[model samples]
Target: MSSSLRVSPFSHAEEIDFIQLVKITLQRKKLVAAITVSAGLIAVACAFLITPTYEVSSVLRPAAINELDALNRSEVYKLPPGEALTKVGASLESYETRLGFFRANPGFFKEFEAPGRTLEQSFEEFNRNSISLILPDPRKADSLSAYIKLEMTYPKGVDGVSILNGLVNYAIDTEREQIASDMRVIIKNRLTEIAGKLDAARANYEVDKEAKIASLSELDNLRRAQLQDERKALRAQLKTLRTDRVAQLDEAIGIAKSLGIRKPSTPSLLGDSERSPSNSVMRTEINNQQIPLYFMGVEALEAERNALMKRKSDDFTEGRIAQIAKELQLLEANREIEVLKSREKEDLFLAGVQPLRAEEARLRNLSIDMAGVKLVTIDRPAQEPLTPFKPKRLLVVVIGIILGFIVGCALAFIWAFIRNRQSFYRTLPISSSGAGATSLDGEPPRIS
Candidate 1:
């Protein structure tokens, strides 16, 4: 049983030889150098073809406390330096603010315009790529300083310095205007509130005045009615007294005529037995009883009755009637109600409104010119950069050379590998049956 070992090409294991590859790469140094030089030249050309971009930047810091003193002192609106700085930073980052600046200054942004892009599209691209708002990192210690950096990069022909400075100014102005507008709104609302309070107070005053007048008038009317009733009663009593006096005088006259008395006579003038038994119609036995009307002679009684009938008013006889008449007269005018109704300055009567009026006046006279107010302080204004930031020619050339050298070495190794494989195949011996020869060890040959 004699078996021959056959060595197939697939059965040979290949091993890497770095030293060989290095030798092959060195042998093809000229080709590597040529590729590197070509790549360097291409990089130079690319550097020249690319548009140079220049950057302009500005640093913003919090405004001084004195700069914002006026606004703070107004008491209507108060803004701190740190808060103002934050607002300015927010405005700088606002897309709407940038767009508004662009729209206002179309000539300054002319360079951003391209053939295929509209003005809006160009602005969008510029805003996205060229504009940068760098705020302090909150994680770092420097964040305590609270600074904002605004940067704008533009092509060579574009005025990046002017654009950056102008944008910063625009942002500051926009923030100032917004603050002023807010203040105005606050003042307006405050004034409106004060006015409403004043109106309410005035309305309330009017209502109170009317109520007081009605109360006083009603009181006067009630008092007058009472006095009128008293006066009527007194007058009726006086009239009844007059009528009773006339009746008594008439009876006394008749009795005096029946007794033949023609003048005033005392009871003692009558005879003791002729006292008419002390119970006659002209006299009374009871000591508490009033004197009889017949005691006066007929002539005197007739004269008294005539005088009573001739009297016009009993008011003079009664002092209370006179007082009641005076009181009624006074009630007819109601001086308190008259004074309340005739008042022209009703505001003076409203209590606790002095402070409100003073506040309203202060708000009305509030003179705040926000234009002069500084919202943010510029630490470093944008300056024209002499050198372009992009398209570093030397660095680009060096990188291109390195990449070309790497590619050239790879190509050299590949070519050397192909040549070695071909030479190995040619040197292998073939068998009589046109097959590969067998190894003497009866194992696959290792390829190195």
Candidate 2:
């Protein structure tokens, strides 16, 4: 019922002239064919004349963070950073290679770096400045198959040479854009990671320094105890010497009294109080009962002092008396001095070690606080290919030929339709003997 309604305005009698259309298309087939073939050939020919380009790439892993113990932390205390410090340097170098390969040639780099730096420094600075990551384009893929196909594809354009130049420039520019960005991201992330590690090391150094300070204080206390013991021994030896000398002095006095020699009442006889010794003729006035008067105390100390200036003062009985007297005075003075020294030792014991300990503490803490994170670098380097890696001519030619054949088939099908052979109707003619059906109204079917 729907088919009988018929939607189109045009009558079946006014259908297209298939044979006329066939004649027209047949006449234009050569033109279309010529143009298609020429385009395919031009594309194939362009591949040969393009300037060849090469690429080289380098890969690397960034360093990892090191776990630190106290002892290991100490070694770097106040010490300059080691090779691990140069990771940034190494990373920068990688960036330069990646960016430089894409950015510009080596000659421009040399010229730019000629001032204010040695050849090496200039190179390092250049690498630092030029290093960057090139990101990949979403549309441009580098799958193994894609790469292989790209390598095999033919180039196409006007004049062949023009297309080849365009392809080479495009490839270089595309590489600069895509690879550089990806490498930059990798490099940036690696540098940030290294920085974080360094921060951790610095924190460790702080803790280590505090521990060292505590240890140093404990050592100072130990040393103070030992020094006090030594001072006590020196005092004991001095006391023993003083007692023995006093006993000998008493015996010397008894001998002089028994001999009936009276000592001078005044210190002049012994030259105490800085007085000169009396003349020998005056010796009779110094009797046995008075023998101890001149020699007992301060006078004896003076005599001792004078006698020490004479030769052999300690070798003889008389000289021994003077020596003992001098010895006694010195011992007394030393005892007093020792009293003061004990106080000073206590003061200085910690005084001497404390500052040094503090400094050590500070340095250790600095190391730990600095946290010994060594830098790690990751990189993608610029590459020079050993062979031209692009524009596969053979593959391009094959594809173009396949496309032409498909087009040829389509054209053949279209031409066949346009020809519209009448044999189709002749072979299967409609049976005109059947009765024509009437509409529901029972009159001839009204043409719509």
- Candidate whose lDDT is highest: 1
- What are the TM-scores, per candidate, against the unseen true structure? 0.78, 0.27
Stretches of candidate 1 exceeding 4 Å from the true structure: 1-42, 258-261, 265-295, 400-448
* Candidate 2 lDDT over residue span 415-434, tens digit each: 65434333232233222343
Distance (Å) between predicted and true CA of 232, model 2? 28
- Model 2 scores worst on lDDT over the 10 consecutive residues at 145-154
Residues 106-152, model 1: lDDT tens digits? 88888889898887898999999999999888888756688999988
True lDDT of residue 370, candidate 2: 26
Off by over 4 Å in 2: 1-36, 49-53, 57-320, 325-387, 421-448
User: Per-residue error at 365 for model 1, in Å?
Assistant: 0.8
Q: On a 0 to 100 scale, what is the lDDT of residue 323 in model 2?
A: 48
RMSD of candidates 1 onward, in order = 7.3, 19.2
